[model samples]
Target: MVLHAVPPTVPRLLTDRSTSEPDREALVVDGVGALTFGSWQRRATGLAERLRQRRVAPGDRVGLRFGAAEWLDFAVAYVAVQRLGAVAVPVSGDAAPAEVAHALADCAATGLVHGGGAPGWTGGWTHATADGDDDTGDGADLSTSDGLAQILYTSGTTARPKGVAATHANVTYGAGARHRPFRHSRHLLHAFSIGTNAAQVMLMTALLAHPAVVTLPQFTPLRFARAITRWSAGTVFVVPAMAMELLAVADGHDLSSVRLLGSAAAPLPGPVAARLAAAFPNATIVNYYTSTEAAPAQTAMTYDPERPDSVGRPIAGGGLRVTDEDGRPCAPGEIGAVWMRSPAPPRTYVGDTTTSGATFQDGWVRMGDVGYVDDDGFLFLVERDGDLVKTGAHRVSTLQVEAAIHEHPEVADAAVVGLPHEVLGVELAAVIVVSGGAALTPPALRAFLAGRLAPHEIPSLVHVVDKLPRNRGGKVDKRSLRRSLT
Candidate 1:
């Protein structure tokens, strides 16, 4: 059942939940422990007190270093920072010391709290504790009081990761902008690292909607399936990469209670989406799309066999426009640059004005996507940011080629990139990970996509490998793949 409207602040939501159902299970870390709403608050309060003692004043940025397996501690520190009117800068638990240093410096973080996952980070800040008086978490939640609440870093696939500063509303999004407990899914589940935007979504959803949010310390196919069975989770969020793992072992676990399964981060390759749809027959399989900078303006599509490639239209109060290279609007079926506009405050690149200016234009954020809206207004993503391949006179979409490759039943996952070619400027290449050790050849795959893609879209060369290279966020590392193969 739906609860009443929620407070604007993150801490306030926790406070209200504890006030309403102090005994209810608010968070569960599979294989580790569980916390009631009240218990979680005490720890957050304890953390806040420590931060205050360390001179972490309002508007200060506190770096949270935790790995995928340390959600409980990460959760406490994240809220504790907000409790003190400070911005939370989450650094992935597994980040290299150098990477962590860059993120901390980029946000001008004053201190750091580790979950023991950041092995070499030399930054300062005490680990969060939950031993304080019950009144500790009772402090005002200034998350929504104006200044930034979080500075999430984009995956540094190309260069230095940019800090994307988000206000409380920006990070929370408040159950699609409504402040209420959206309990359509009684319990929520996910295995996302704390720093990513998708993980923040799960965090906010747990506070605003799901009664008990269960998370895996680190997402493993077997562990993920077990969490759903053990907690009887009704909703689960996974990136396509994690989704692949879940699909591999879903048969060994009892996942009958799940009612909604969502995928975000990168597009769920067509074959994987289809597999997920079949695996969770009782659930509505959803394909959602969002980025670190472009959020709330996200798109979602319930799996439709007839149009599995479509990422669906923009959410309410938001829309997408496809513009040609010349900055002119494209008609339906015409591919071009995709831009997103949402009602939330526009995002800013913390210290990089040149990149921010090029990305955030007028009121719309350049999604750095190349795709088009269909006749039905559905937005189908062709390629993501910097995911273009210049081939001869054609600019080919790697995603299009990957999707076509994924359509082949023998293929498990695929990544496409452009390689330098003496005659055509750049030629297409594909790295494919086959399903069940299935036999496939570059020539056979090319013939399969012949009807679906243009001559230039098919990979001129294909590498059959055991796996595709993926970055920390579970997205294909096209650049790395290109560099290695070339």
Candidate 2:
């Protein structure tokens, strides 16, 4: 198999002479405006120069807090910072002030840029100063594949968010490898938040590959459909949740131009994938499983109904291993902890070196996901190891119930766990938190779940908790919840 390698510096690859076309639309923000490659480069270079003038030294961390409208500016600023040998940590606009504060403190950011509202820092950016400077220098001081580029925080399900340190080399290499098969002329649509590694990779890949990118400030079914139609985007990247939302409003939209649909963030439930494949018959639905710690290690399933559950196969320069509790490799079809080893995995967790060293063992990094690889090399994700609910006699995967409950329009947020049961050891339980003004009763929820979940899998007890406890990192804290139940 042939392996593709990317240069250590991503900005250099993106701004190369051949890739920089004066008339090509490099980026488009919904209502704000559009920028051609020539415009984007000039603006990015100017921003880079401004940061340099502000005494932003190489390797300094800069925080970006903006909505989808400023995505183009954010991307350009990100590259600009990299060009100046600085790191850009972009936080989601939807994130709470506390969450924003956590990220800023975690990265020890020297400056912050927000679309609106005052941040907790001295230096920041507003809408007025977005296109102020031209700082493109001939040579950009970047990390040599091993040097740290950005610190992406994980979805803190279990605890406070830990910053995953990604190097310029690792990101560039992963982006290049993933985009190698993609044609450069196609317009790409990404529906994820710019703060996520998935979105970052997509943006970088599109830039490096010279693909036109159409972006939205937030993921809305209507907006997404409209953007697809307006941009004539040939490819799109969506999460399973976004895919479901899009499917709900897909009627009356002309999505004939889309050739490929990349789904990530969570496993595309077999039924959901099937529905998507049916809906977008012309497009190939690629189910990708990746993490902030390890870029995209596997492309388990590829829009084929025949093998719906399979995540596909590992990419080059990466390997997957399924092992039992004893550390021995599990036989085909048997569930085990999913461990992966990537040559260019994240080096460390910023500010938290203790847990960082423990995250990777030998060469394999524990993905914290439980699943098994079949004999044919297909990966099936059962659940996250921490999400496994051990009831009296059965071990259930909370992901199964969460998926089933999410299928209900009223149930916006769902978290499942095992609660202490007097007679049945640990009994299946669920804490359902509804969305919008939707009302959920225990009996109604139980009745709704009856046909969807198995007898053993159904929550024996249901609680209409005000809010399921989420850790600092935004992931459901089952351990903390379990402790409260006990």
lDDT of 1: 0.79
The CA root-mean-square deviation of candidate 2, after full C-alpha superposition on the true structure, stands at 4.3
Write model 1 residue lDDT over 350-370, tens digit each, in one string: 989788887899878898778
TM-score of 2: 0.84
- Candidate 1 TM-score versus the reference: 0.92
Ten-residue region with minimum lDDT total, candidate 1:
1-10
RMSD of each: 2.6, 4.3
TM-score per candidate, in order? 0.92, 0.84
State each model's CA lDDT, in order.
Answer: 0.79, 0.72
